[model samples]
Target: MSSDTSKFGEYGGQYVPEALMPAIEELDDAYRRYVLENEDGFVDEFRERLRDFGGRPTPLQRADRLSERYDTDLFLKREDLLHGGAHKLNNALGQVLLAKYMGKERIVAETGAGQHGTATAMAAAHLDVPCEIYMGERDINRQRPNVFRMRLNGAAVNPVTTGRGTLKEAISETMRDWATTVETTHYVIGSVVGPHPFPTMVREFQSVISEEARRQFDDQVGGLPDSVVACAGGGSNTMGAFSRFVSDESVDLYAVEAGGSSLAVDEEEGVAPNSASLSTGTEGVLHGARTKLLQDRDGQIVESHSVSSGLDYAGVGPELAYLVDEGRVTPVTVDDDAALEGFHRLSQTEGIIPALETAHAVAWLEQATSEQLGDSVVVCVSGRGDKDLESVIEETASREIPNAPDMDVFSGGMR
Candidate 1:
């Protein structure tokens, strides 16, 4: 909410077609009116909805067993318990509220694992607005339960088959849809990506995570955690977790990425690496905002791979790109097998089934140490994994096969 900034230190800007400018302007104006200008209690109304309808003030719980195993103090910000089953609902509710203020009759959104799509659909249904969700055909199959949930919430799910048929393509398709229907439609971008106002807007909506966590951590732990961690795709969850802590230099921030198949690759055909974007990608634009993106030497975007459908993207949020350049956030990568192990570990040890996306943060513990992690660490368990049961079963079956590459990476976060 800094009046002095829109571009995140040269990482975020409006790099879209000229035709989209008016819609962006209108959106910015409406957001300022409804959210920033709050004499009418617009923000309080939103807070009421979040607490009573969407379930805010999600608990911060100590992970005694997991902490014992890791030999470090571990805490979980249980965003998994929120209604709609993920941190996606926070942004979805706020954006839908903005759409209502803008007099938009319909909502358009994109999803990778279907969590955001389902969350948006539920928000639209609650507010009695028509909703359309663009998701990849591949993601719909892997995340079928969420697809059904979206349908049940009265939202239309459009499958995008172009490109890698994942998050990036879904965003492309959503952008195309929003372009033509700008009059009646509002694009509820699910993550901290997209053009100027969006990356900042989503962060504000999701900032409730850190705002509540900071006080709760002080109350529970009697001090700030030494480190805060979350999985990063478009980086909403990570941004939320790190929002307040970023200014506290003594607290370390870690953003774990999806190391789909390999942590590093050089022109290997059919091999995709989703992690190492800020670490390896060049400055580029994707989904309207200029940031770090995986691309070839010719500047064409390359394919990104991930076992977790949610973290399967070729780019990250502009704010995260800024944080990377400033060295405020340490970027790390966790591969499929390691993340799967994290999923199992939490389920067995803590009785929590995390979404595959959140598992990537948990997977970082395999290679971590008490010295580096320090006495207290908080990891955002961003979502529950009920939607990923079938996928996890198949991944476990693949691991049972001898000579499977997964076994080697099981001990490490990288492929």
Candidate 2:
């Protein structure tokens, strides 16, 4: 896709009113100039900050036990080691710096899992900019740890009660806030699924993952990875890890989506839910751009449930939809049980507990091995599992176990 027409694949043109176009155009122009001229320095500065401030080049460890269990080569890109514990900091650092360069006073963002909110708060604190994070009431409750982290970082967290009180509702609130205060407040979108300059801009900032992964894999294994996999909520981490390999058609790109319960047999129906939008969704306009959405015939967005809070979104980014359509990317869905299982498996085997969101990618290893994927598969472990301990324990306690024949038999006693 050329730069001029890259705004929308087939579905994502500027559908906003005339007033908003100029603002969007201005952002696009400024971003284009920044990318063309100053990106080299911006990237270098960001890397230094990530190394000294945020921690860069997190180890790409080979998952020996996981590889043996799955019978395939599996390597983990340890993004969970980054400061703030996810890929959110990459974009937050870039955008916050850009906001500083533009002389913006306040920064505002919307977050679902609160990872992005916390990261943004950290950046704003570093830059001494006023920051506000809008989150849905439900999400705030579910992701309280991150909310508190953001508050400790000095960001005021506002709860959105309108609509479904989820990420979508939070997005609506953020958009309204941005429209009213666009001049002094820079809205930092958390993912790659937003407006034009946003999708492109966020992707550029996140491309650092693939850039480093390319060199790291070469140093470790002496060549590019055979496959690169990441969980896709709005696809920031996935896009980041896949950007440098975009032109490398020979390298495989796998995007894992939340597939709840459908993977386990003997489990009751609906025990797990599936939120695979690209596989089961249709083209539609959602959250400012045209993309694949899990919606009904009447155009109302359907309620999407996933074990991963981050991947619970109803719509995906335009570029991903384009890639899926062109067969450049493969989309797979894993159930909640599988993801939870994969989480425990990785934790026990590799001593690396991954976020529930990132576990969806690990779960894909099961399917990938079954399909005979090659020896080297790199999975993006986007965040640590610290946030999911409670849920994991709760789910484990709820499982059913069969009764043993007799305890006396094990004790060598007569019954």
Candidate 3:
């Protein structure tokens, strides 16, 4: 609402091309007038969509089995149940509505893992706006199901082959496109990782997650949880799940990073090996935000690798960076193997299949002993796993821990 909300502890600000200044300033003004001021029923219409369309007040379910296994009480905030299959829809729908208020007819977004892309496309379709999504060529190949979903919603998905063909390059490309189409287009950033207004804007929309979870948790548990955990990749869901609890001194907050592999400090330069940006990064600027980043000695951003594409970003949200620096948030990591195990365990035990991105939080929660975390913990089950069947299949086949019985040759499985 006010410009004071921008620049989280000296982390977020307008750092972009001169051409983008007007657009950023305009959107900032609109955010204040429409969202902060609630001008002309804008907030009313947005809240209605969240309730009727995006499925607000998502459930907070108790994970009894997981709790018992880890000797602690575990609860899940099910944002996965939201429309478009993940927490991305919260921001996507909000931005689409704001774009309408701004008189922008077209939308462009950058996505990794395609959850944000699908959410953007879905919101655009519902609002009858033209939409285009930028994705890396590699992401298009691995995340084909989501790419198809975007096309089905009438969104044009552009593939970038530059610079490892991942989210970083896709962001670079999307920013360039937005610079040219600033008059008629609004750039819908997928997460809470962009410049000043964006990190603040997206977080506000997603804050609904924590707001709902807080009330629900209080109703169910009669007290604040011992800790709240969420995976951090660009940090929208984490910010959503943790923002409300920052002042609750008794509640510990955890942001689990993509533990791709060994926690070696510099296993891979430019990339946070195992995708642990906070654990293996120096402070630098990337993608128009000043925050914790992974770069080489020469200060070039490197490519990050993780089984979950969403976590493979070189930089993290400025708010999260500030939180980490201030010691208000603790950063941990879970590798790909642990994440997949959590995926399999939850699907088998709770009948819930979490997205690879979300599984990281689940994995960390399951691994933390009762003493490590308190008797009760809440995890942000950020998204569903329908988009990850292919990757999971490929990973499980190579894993040797739990043997699968051989199936009949003709039949796909044992009769």
Candidate 4:
């Protein structure tokens, strides 16, 4: 698609520096040919690799305990079961493969929770390509396990210390790296938030979640679900879960965002206590796209906070902003405490440990009204909680998380 057609209404556009135009243009062409048109059996190969390597068709199982609690038929789209233990692999593998086909010899990317970094590293290793990942220093410390996983998979993990040491800075640093090394490197953006082909391309790659869930729901549940909910940070999995259901007017799509501590913004301090951009953000340009952002009155980007490092972002994906504007998707929020409760609740009841990011969606289910959910709902379990164990323990201990397990035994720390 052309730059104009790339947009979801006016929420998307190429707003990058002039130096990155050639790389963006080239990637757009490759996206059209390989991804859109499936040139050289690319789509076929991608699917084959996904099945044999990355593990396609993750289960869409009914959450019996959660359903009983919510008084609705609740199903979980178990993306956590996929290789790399999250939905990140779907896009990472696809982008890395695309880069290989485009004859790029190196891969670069940004990560917040480290799921994407780990996934990218695994894909690059499998494809025999050199890879590097830029991560915020704070996130690197919080997500040390994932950092180790990436290095184990043979990718360099570069820490970005600028700004709040979070997703925004990592993305900015990656863009700078890509701008300088555009000819030899492909920047595998982890989410559907960047310029032109990236938002569209990442969504298409990750849409397998809903594609399979939709089919499986029909087969198992006998009809369409009443609502489809997923956590929205930069909106890869959000768009993925909602894309296939967008045309289905009967299906309600809910994008649950992080409501860190409060929705209030300290404009003078340039900090927002939440990442609920979809719910409260105004329009602005950020990270090469025009979308909803947590910007001050003077248009300065504000810092965003979230207990889950993955969900802390100043802006959301352009398409998600457009969809919310069009009223096709409803934007919602769940506070950090509720999310922590959800993290423990699911683990106790459903025998599944969800990532703190996924916990946001789970928490919303508890807060949502019966009328909002209808009779059947599907929540995307975006990732497993293995990466968030340390953060969860610390946060759970700091607050009185109702569903949290006994912590007195490990009061010192998990050795």
Candidate 5:
């Protein structure tokens, strides 16, 4: 992985224009220097802060009840236990610290689920730097809890209403903000997407999960698991878990995408629910990088829909798209019902309420059982359900077809 000139694979090369190349190159240089010269102490300090402040090394627990029910071995990499209640904080801390080291002030970021927004805000508060987060008006309405958390942490949240008022639009707003304030502001992208160093940089910070999970799983199971599973929105948690094990060909890496309604059918007119970037997306430029996006024949990006706010994007990270194309990663889709069912199952069975984003992985576990994955699968529980409670309750309560059969009637019968 290190031998490759690009970050993860060929998909992660710097793809910005000549004008931004210097800035990208400078960031790459700084990051490379920091990794080579300061990684040891930097990582130690970061880990200390994670434990004492950010709350990390979250447990890797056996989902015994779910495993028993599904007749498959299931373990959760409990990132939900991390401070700020998601895996976002891991990279946020790394980036914010890097900003401080570089003598930059005023952190800026964009968020969809608000996990990243809250994480960035928390990091800025800890480092005593002013922070601003751009969120979609739709997301601000949906993820109210996180918006409140951001304010409490002393960060300003700006709502963007252009376009469809979703993640893609918020990203555009953020980029515009970054272009205007590039000198003194560091734009902390939430996930392993975007252009150049962002995909590489975010992955490096989040790679800690794979590093720790490998050691923990090795100690507990005597070797690596048969497969590593994670929910991929912007592909951070999946990248976090897969980065360390990418060289281990024996371990299968599975990424679950949000199949909103019918996994077998597209929710969009003439596009299948599974037709999002991973499946139907074509190579194109979006969010400052050439990536696989679900676009029309005329190259207009099509709107994407998913019950989970985090996964409702029209494009995926370039690296992930390359991984999908190269067959290094297998992408699976789980419908909204399955995801909600998985969310309820985890909450009732293991007392672990997962974020709607993380629930995608849980839903995949249900399918994995029928395929007989044996007792060796680890799912990245990327975020907690605290941010998703109200929506989950509302979703689970609204019955689909009156008198419809309750698939999980035994799992406490809806929220």
Candidate 6:
């Protein structure tokens, strides 16, 4: 751990309201003891559960077709193959288990893309704990499959209708609930954002991505890749893919952000056409942490757009913001069109359907120069696309994506 513990350079700290202080303090202590010190074999049990339940040691497979197409050695960290079809299970299971250890009776979480909510629902069910999820109403409509999955796992799904009906509003609602019910409920933050202990604790759990990748890369390919790429929203997967590789000066990390329709913002309307916070955001305090955010000149958070619901966040993880500022992680953007193309490209060529969020990272391959990518590269495929089929069909039909297949065949429905 760093000397400061609660912060990543100048970015992370507990900036919550007074009502949430006790919960934060308790969580901070629990994180230090169970997570950091591994009290009562907590770490051992967590690993065993991950192996037996959540499916750890996800594959690091070489992408032969992608490599041949790009004339480079390309690899994929297959987090999409995890039990819940996303890297979200890594942190979700860990946090839920921690809550059990802390004697919490219920779990509450906020989700945008719904992967995190599904993972939390699964974990809560597996652990025999009650769970409730707060999600933006718009996202619920966009990701109905995931909503059904959460309900099937015996979790209640609450719709947050405030503030554009998206992640920011959902988080605010969850936090409000937590503030009132902190004694019996634990909040499972979906990503590497939020106040103290959450950013650090979530990273420690999610770091298993890079931990396995770094070892697998050395054993299979004999050295670090020249570059590692992963999509960044709230940046759990981005930090997961880059955490273990950060100390290696020779390895370059790229954080692909959703560029939406454009990078320009309508300050008067308080809307940013892109979710490229790490690329175009200025420093601001949001969601209890200091980080780069898509904000208007008056310091109000602006609405962000993304074809992928998962990447529609207005701010990024503080650690990722610090890393970008330190020049350890490069921030890049992929427009919705390129991301759609990459989604189809991977499905057609590699026989893999990536989540639209992961497609942002895939799109970067096409946008980056060969020299920029280097000869050896690794891309983290964060989630599967099953939950995105409806959105993809709709969005692809509206855009002139040259690689998109005919969607008319699905007129009878995806069944």
Which regions in candidate 2 have their CA more than 4 angstroms from the true location? 1-4, 17-19, 39-41, 261-273, 370-372, 400-415
Q: Write the per-residue lDDT of candidate 5 for residues 1-415, one digit (tens) a residue.
A: 2222564444556565455566566667767767445754766677778778877688888889877877766788989988988999999999888887777788989999899999999999998999999999998998999999999999999999997677888888888887777778888899888777788778888988888888888888779888899998778888898989888988888988888765443335534354256765778777766777777676777777777888878878777888888898888888788888888778778888899989888878878744535558888999999998878877877845232235465577466
Clash totals in order? 0, 8, 3, 0, 4, 0
**Could you tell me every candidate's TM-score relative to the true structure?**
0.94, 0.90, 0.95, 0.98, 0.91, 0.98
Candidate 1 structure quality by residue, lDDT tens digits, 257-343: 988778665565633576557667789988889999888776777888888988888889999999999999998888788888888
Q: What residue runs in model 6 are displaced by over 4 Å at the alpha carbon?
A: 1-4, 410-415
Weakest ten-residue segment in model 5 by summed lDDT: 1-10
Q: What ordering of candidates by TM-score runs from best to worst?
A: 4, 6, 3, 1, 5, 2
How far does residue 390 in candidate 1 sit from its true spot (Å)? 0.6
lDDT of each: 0.87, 0.79, 0.88, 0.94, 0.80, 0.95
Weakest lDDT window of 10 consecutive positions for candidate 6: 1-10
Note the residue pairs that clash in candidate 1.
none
The candidate, 2 or 4, that scores higher on lDDT is 4
Give all candidate RMSDs, comma-separated: 5.1, 5.4, 2.2, 1.7, 4.1, 1.9
Better of 1 and 3 by TM-score: 3
Q: How many Å off is the CA of 338 in candidate 4?
A: 0.4
Which ranges of candidate 4 are over 4 A from the true structure?
A: 1-4, 411-415
Residue pairs with backbone overlap in model 5: 50-55, 265-273, 266-272, 266-273
Question: What is the overall TM-score of model 3 with all chains considered together?
Answer: 0.95
Clashing pairs in 2: 50-55, 259-334, 259-335, 260-272, 260-273, 260-335, 260-336, 261-272
lDDT (C-alpha) at residue 77 in model 5 = 92
